[model samples]
Target: MTNLMETLVENREMVQPNHANMLDTAHGGNVMKWMDEVGAMSAMLFSGETCVTARVNQMNFERPIRVGDTAYITAYVYDSGTSSVKVRLITEREDLRTREREKTTESYFVYVAIDEHKEPTTVPDLTVSSEEADRLRREALEGENGNC
Candidate 1:
């Protein structure tokens, strides 16, 4: 079994001019790409196998990440089936100068573990070890009820 905490993955990216859209904010496509990368990492950590993105639940962009701001992307396995892992992903905009941060995007990604032959494989069960892990799991489940 893999603990939910063990599958946690966090990545930081500085929004550069190339990543920005016409409004000088990070492009939605760029953010989605980053989320997918980190989400896959979390799923691989939980399954101990290469994983491919199977589905991406509705993605909500509540705010914009301006250029020069740091984008903090976090992902963790919240649920899993025989071969699929669901990861909760959150993106935050952080101003390094003031150290202020706020969530900007949130979504859930599902991945399936695959073997060398590119066939789906079973994954270990997920375990929540601490209060924080439990809370995260609960939030991931409850958050689905609201508009993503």
Candidate 2:
């Protein structure tokens, strides 16, 4: 069994000019790339095997991440099947100077664990070790129901 908390992954990226669009805001593609990376990491942690993205649930970009801000991305595995892992991903725009942060995007990504032969492999059951993990799992489930 893999603890849900053990699959938690967080990453930060500085939104520099190169990562921005013509409007000087982080491009949607760039944000998606970051989310995918973090989500894969979380899935791999949970599955203890290499994982590849299989599907991405509807993603909503609620706000823009302006250049010079920081993109804080978080991902956690909340559920799993024989080979699939579901991860909740959220991105926040943070102003390092002011230390202000606001949610910018949210999505659910599914990954499939793979063995060395590149075939789908089974994954261990997900376990919650603490109240916080339980709460996060609940929140992810609610968000999947379109509460986000």
Candidate 3:
């Protein structure tokens, strides 16, 4: 079993004009895509194999990110079962001109480990050894909302 702490991933992308909507703000779809990709990377890190998005519990966009801003996303495995892992994703936007940052999106995603055959595969147990992991675990559980 691999240690989940080493599987975390952070990815960032510049918000381009094409990634924005008519309002000139980063489109929700683009943000979701970024979250999904980062979550998948974390899943793959934990499983040491391919994984797929089984579900996204909730994605809330709190603010808008304008073009030329940098969208930073972080994904980490907070918990896991025999065949699935829970990933926490946080997205923030940084303005280059003002050198300011604001959290624009937050989401929790569940991914299922899969093998080359595209069948569900068992994953390594997630280990929470650091304070950050503990906090993330608690946050991920909040997404369960009594019904994961």
Candidate 4:
């Protein structure tokens, strides 16, 4: 079983002008792309197989990340089913000059492992390794009323 704490995945992307909109803020599409990529990494790490996005739960942009900021995205497997892995993605914007960070977005995404034929493949069960990990998993489940 993959432990939630150890299964967490993180990636960073430098926000460029091209990645932003006319408002000089990071585009929503770019943020979604980062979330999807990070979520897929977490799913693959937990499943030990290639995974594709199955569904994206409520993705809300809490704040706008301006261009020239660094986007830090972290994802972890919070729950799992027969072939699906549920991942929670959190995004924060870091001011490179000031070394400050602000949360920008959060979303829950589901990924399904797939075989060469693109058929769904099984994923191992998730295990919570620490109190914090257990709490996070519980909170993620409760966020969706246990639907996740």
Q: Pick by TM-score: which candidate is best? A: 2
Tens digits of per-residue lDDT, candidate 2, 1-148, equal 9999999999999999999999999999999999999999999999999999999999889999999999999999999999999999999999999989999999999999999999999999999989999999999999988846
The CA lDDT at 112 in model 3 is 91
Best by lDDT: 2
Ranking by lDDT: 2, 1, 4, 3
Error at 134, model 4, angstroms: 1.1
Tell me how far the alpha carbon of residue 132 in candidate 3 is from the true structure, in angstroms, after superposition.
2.9
Give per-residue CA lDDT, model 1, range 20-82, as digits (tens).
Answer: 999999999999999999999999999999999999999889999999998999999999999
Which residues of candidate 4, in runs, are more than 4 Å off?
146-148
Q: What TM-score, over all chains together, does every model reach? A: 0.97, 0.98, 0.90, 0.93
Tens digit per residue, CA lDDT, model 3, 30-139: 99998999999998988887889998976778999888898989888888888998888889998777868888888778899888899999998777787876776777
lDDT of every predicted structure (CA atoms): 0.95, 0.96, 0.84, 0.90
Per-residue lDDT of model 4, residues 51-127, tens digit only: 99999998779899989898999899999999999998889999978989998988889899999899999989899
* Clash counts for all predictions: 0, 0, 0, 0
Q: Show model 1 residue runs off by greater than 4 Å.
A: none
What lDDT does candidate 2 reach at residue 137? 99
Provide the RMSD of all predictions against the true structure, rounded to 1 decimal.
0.9, 0.9, 2.1, 1.9
Q: Which window of ten consecutive residues has the lowest lDDT sum in model 2?
A: 139-148
